[model samples]
Target: MESGLAGWVQTIGYIGIFAVVFAETGLLVGFALPGDSLLITVGILGAAGKLQLFPAITALFIGSFLGNNLGYWLGRWAGPGLQRRVRADHLERTQLFMRRFGALSLLVGPFIPIVRALVPFVCGTLRMPYGRFLPLTLLGSLIWTVGLTLFSYWVGSKIPNLEKYVYLILLVGISAGVVPAAIRFFRRRSARSVEM
Candidate 1:
């Protein structure tokens, strides 16, 4: 989970923001591209006068928008093919999430980490229409990017020393992200043990 590219990307300004956001949200190969880190890093850079907040936000917003659309297409084309080859955990989660969220899941899924990587595939498998998926997904990406970016900017302004403790903050952010899933996992484990 060490992000080697994060340092390089942080230095390149808007292009960096677009590339990272695009890959993380749209390409499965990019799930490790540091979505949260991008937000915080940009904010810190902005505070340090290396980047401007509005430009950073705009680039990320567009990147996120385009990436999700591309993901939906990849999902649509590759989804069923992948599903037919797997009858294991992937299939189970695929069915479960699809059953629960339907096509709208594509719109919500990009915000959810591991789930973010799978939504486009699910959308493809379900043959969800592109027109239906585009607007909502874009809206969601804008909100997610701007909100997190602004939050990071705000925190950076107050601290102004994020570069020194960025890793610590990332660790804390990661823990915060994992807590709910961890709680649910533990609860499931406990219930299973009790049943046995």
Candidate 2:
């Protein structure tokens, strides 16, 4: 699965990567896409000189920033009707996340998969000022894009023939990205069941 995904990334190149990032961040259906894993693969490839590091990073940032902007607008356009269609618990949790973190959720959301996809839209429905959303979104995009890409690139550069182990690396990245969220969801469900 990892090799196949990496191959797809390589086949798609910069524009494809941009589109994936945009959809993942902007579109509701994009939550299932492999955003983190793709970045790790891209960084590794860039280090291997199969892809250009700077261009890959730029694509990531642009896609994320624009995608988030689109999501916010979509939320505004769709309003509460869209929120009503979402699972009640998911909507509640996202609202809780926004309340708990305030503006910092924008910074943190980029690191979390489902939350990253939903935060901007939630912000829009809640009518968060665009002036405020823009800068935080920009900063979040920059940090996530640069931090992940450069770290993976450095790892790729230091380890000879790192591409051979790219699948393993992606497995770990996927696990790292997903496990905690799964655990949290289950724990919350268990707690709710116990309360009942």
Candidate 3:
């Protein structure tokens, strides 16, 4: 069942991968998509010779960068009106993340799932200078796309018949990306309750 699922993912090809990455990073509706797992799977496929490594990496990077730009502009266009529509707690958390991290948040955001999608929009709403946002976002996208892809590729290449364990790899990748966010959320909730 797992191999079959991985096979299906491989069959989607580069364009499908690109679309997933683009929507996951750009659109608010994409929050639930498995961006990290997809990237790792792409890397493993590349190692298994099921996909071209260079083009896959290129497509992933382009999709992420462009998607972030789309989110930024959308936020800019919607302005404060968008903020009102968003859950107040989510907006507040995003704002606090930006405030605590400043510009570094753009670079780090790609590693955090929901934050990856929201930070650019928040920056846009705040009118972060394009000159600054562009390069940082570009760097972040590159680091995220290339780093995960290559690491997974390397692992696939090293392990004999690693493709058989794709599900395990995916589980690890998803956990790595999600566990920290969950911890942070629970901690924050506890802290808030203490205050109240």
Candidate 4:
């Protein structure tokens, strides 16, 4: 994911941070996006004197916190009716999974791509209380945001010439993220075309 946006990642500054972190926590599609990497990238840039690590980290933390909160509320309000109408067996699966893994899912869901968004929605649909999720949400956000931010700074600093060609690294990161999916998408499309 960072490969795709490595160059732009460092140069684009706060805008990138806002987009990645917010999408990661708030949007279901963002599960695949590189919130962790972006933070690390930001830190790396800061360590190299290209960007400020503190502000980047702060923005990331706030973005993550708000994103999760928004997602949680969206799910809480969205509920089973939304699920039923949007019905696919996916919702049923969400319900079943929640019965067994609701707490764990809430804690760990943010790490996964598709599941992250769905889990929170499931929690809301299943009526998991906000009191139960509030602390957990904050904890998860901290773990994800701060931990990665520091790691990126440490790692970025150690690497040779990472800052020299930030764009290439960003491209590599984004390519790493989308290439597999693109391959899959094309394969599926080709398969469908053949069928027709």
- Score every model by TM-score: 0.81, 0.89, 0.87, 0.68
Task: For model 3, state the Cα shift of residue 51 in Å.
Answer: 1.0
User: Pairing residues by index, what is the TM-score of model 3?
Assistant: 0.87
What TM-score does candidate 2 reach?
A: 0.89
Residue 5 lDDT in candidate 3: 47
lDDT of each: 0.72, 0.86, 0.85, 0.69
* Candidate 2 lDDT for residue 167: 81
In terms of lDDT, which candidate is strongest?
2
TM-score of 1: 0.81
Candidate 3 residue lDDT tens string, 59-164: 9999999999998998989968767766777677778888999999998888876778789899899899999999999999999999999998998999877777
lDDT of 1 by residue, 92-147 (tens): 66568768977666556656665665666566666777777777777778777887
User: Cα deviation of 100 in candidate 4 (Å)?
Assistant: 6.1
Rank by lDDT, descending? 2, 3, 1, 4
The stretch of ten residues in a row with the least summed lDDT in candidate 2 is 1-10
Better of 2 and 3 by lDDT: 2
